[model samples]
Target: MAPSKPIITVVTGTGAQGRAISRAFHRSGKWHVRVLTRNPTGQVAQALEMEGMELVQGNFEDKGALLRVFEGAFAVYSVTIPPWHQQYDLSMGEYEQGVLQADAAKASNVQIFLFSTLPYVGPHFMGLGGVELYDG
Candidate 1:
């Protein structure tokens, strides 16, 4: 069989890091890129869409929505902006979203999972469901 073009899904697609990663993939032209964001009609989403990227409208809070988006996706790029994320769900909510996303990634049979996290500040694994601190 011919090689299939990879489907890459980037969460928090409107965020700085997320956007950068998405752009990188788009530049490579080796894979099909889709961005997951709550505000699908937002400026950022529209911009990416105009550039030939698929914009999947959904949030981590919605499991059904996530499953639909993940369908046939070969890879997923998970990203959570801790600071701004905390504003949405009392930090706990942010953590929960991450965990949910991870589970969804597995359920969807995504071949590769790439998570983008802060280096110095460290990454938070929402699956733990607890608080941890980082020096940075």
Candidate 2:
């Protein structure tokens, strides 16, 4: 049997950054791309699945689920959901989610891991030219 490619698990695989990262890994042909998302039946997730990526249905709030999501993976890439998406559920912010994922990655003994967060600029702030509305 031929040697298998390294696995790189991407969290939030249906989002913009996740999609880009997943695509880059697929294009390289050097690693098997695995994605974690809550909506595996969504169009984007289905598209990535069709492109040969393994999709793990999960959310960051559950570390146990994340550990499973990271299983058999050499690396994990994660970008916590941005502020805009948290409007409905304000229980956990991006930082909190990032920390949780980092802990899971460590526990899973992943070789490499990345955690990222991007602030959301509310629609009202878009009218203001060149101004960023960071809720810091």
Off by over 4 Å in 1: 1-4, 83-94, 119-136
Q: In candidate 1, how many clashes are counted?
A: 0
Q: Write model 2 residue lDDT over 51-119, tens digit each, in one string.
A: 998888987688888999988889998888755673334357778888888889889889999776764
Residues 1-136 of candidate 1 have per-residue lDDT tens digits of 3226788989877776778788889889898888888888989889988988888887656778778878888998887556554434533344676787788989999889887566223244454543445322
At residue 85, give the lDDT of candidate 1: 48
lDDT of 1: 0.75
Clash count list over all predictions: 0, 0
Candidate 2's TM-score reads 0.83
Q: What's the TM-score of every candidate structure?
A: 0.75, 0.83
